[model samples]
Target: MIHSLDPAPSAQAAMLDGATPLTQLGVIRVEGEDAAAFLHGQLTQDFSLLGLSEARLAAFCSAKGRMLASFVGFKRAHDDILLVCNRDLLAPTLKRLSMFVLRAKARLSDASENFQVFGLAGGGVPAALPTAVWSQWRDGQVSVVRLPAAPGAVRALWVAPVGAAAPTATALAEPLWQWLEVQSGVAMLSQPVVESFVPQMLNYESVGGVNFKKGCYPGQEVVARSQFRGTLKRRAYVVHAEGALVAGQDVFSEGDPDQPCGTVVEVAPHPVQGFDAIVSLQTSAAAAGGLRAGSVSGPHLTLLPLPYSLLEDI
Candidate 1:
């Protein structure tokens, strides 16, 4: 079992903690002669220039620009790419992606059964892996990608063939890993909230999930308009709330309880508090007053500091 590195608090402590099985995530593999060329025309990132040593945070959007799914994608080989996303959306996401492959030589498959994903935090790499965010290294059939971590902490995603040798290092508890994921402020895409927000609404552009200069994809025009027009009125923010907060849950401002001011994009149980969540809401509402989840008398939410700056003026 994994253990904590320091006896501090919960959310922060988890980042400096050990490893855990990322059972909540799933993987999709796209391989063939046209993999790179095909994905370049679909996702929001510049996959054509994605080097073997690097990974990207990308979003697959609908024609209307709403994000269908978000992924931490990396190339396994010159013609192979792996996309990691929430398990619940894998099957449908794969199916939808396949439909667009029409004549491309690329093939999409649910590689979840063939691979086991794990999250490692506050620990040293396996000697064969790199320690920088988005950098990748390989050990046999297992590929490890250094992922963005909380401030002053280290984290990585380990993906290996199901039957391959598992990392012998101790792991952090799964709950702790989930909590840290929310605390990091990178909202995760789940089935309940699919096709909800545009990439910018989730702060994707600021976090390297969107490449504005890249060629067109599904909702390229809409995404471009939002950025260049400066008409985006909503953004994702970090908040702490009492009671259970879940993805797709509504957030309302006390000033106007009749209408929802935001939606809970991602949430997790906090070690010291009831729950921590990344909420996407109107900027004005977030700045006005404290938000409540569920109803007017529902649990009140307090906005917390986001680890990164938003691209509001862009």
Candidate 2:
């Protein structure tokens, strides 16, 4: 909950432009001739498909196939690529990435302070770049819709000169970010949730975070196997609870001692009643219902529908 902004308006015609904490968020700058090609081989997404106007969600993994970090990747006007992830893990994640950059032409640096980030939700997003000169990747602004049908929202970062005017679009309350994130089924991975879920566990493959046809990275073997071999045991699911929740909180099925079922991925202040979070649980426990966080006697978790369907065996 570390924010750099004051508050502003809610609904508007254009964008939800204002400084939002970005709280646990951090950014990494990658620039160079080999930046795109180099990262394509090291990360989960198909970097070759990314352009200045489109952003991609991707993950960095350990050689054993566990995720080291997950990020929302996008390109700036220049040749630079921006990797955004949870703030607390950025420094170490950067160092880890640096170790592998021995001969690559790309450079990685923290760029959190240099960027203006915001979350937009609701009916529709407007066309053009609010008040900032930052480029637009979507048709207008893009936010998640969770009405009759669920839609995946966009978490946008606009990189502009350091003291420029903030966007004139209406500012939304921070909880809207949590609400939209849950609705989109796009779970943010934190330090606690690190190395916990493989890409498919979080539905990364269904969401374009994994590219099987792409070459090798740290844990490609395990990731590819999980996708095509019918061996995935856990998957991401949206869950709502009647109490406080957090990342890494262990979830349990009724009477299941010694064997815990799942882990909480993201939790936020509920836009409505209690608290809502995203959890990755074994298909067994998830299907059994009665999933609780912390212990079998812990807060009750009610599963909700995810925005997208699973692409298992794909």
* Candidate 1, pairs of clashing residues: 2-171, 19-171, 19-172
lDDT of each: 0.83, 0.70
What TM-score, to 2 decimals, does candidate 1 have?
A: 0.92
What are the TM-scores, per candidate, against the unseen true structure? 0.92, 0.84
lDDT of 2 by residue, 90-127 (tens): 99889998888889898989988876555544323334
Off by over 4 Å in 1: 1-15, 124-131, 312-314
After TM-score superposition, the amount by which residue 187's alpha carbon in candidate 1 deviates from its true location, in angstroms, is 1.1
The TM-score of candidate 2 is 0.84
**Residues 72-180, candidate 1, lDDT per residue (tens digit)?**
9988898989999999999989999999999999989999988899887776346566766678887767788887666545678889888987777676778777776
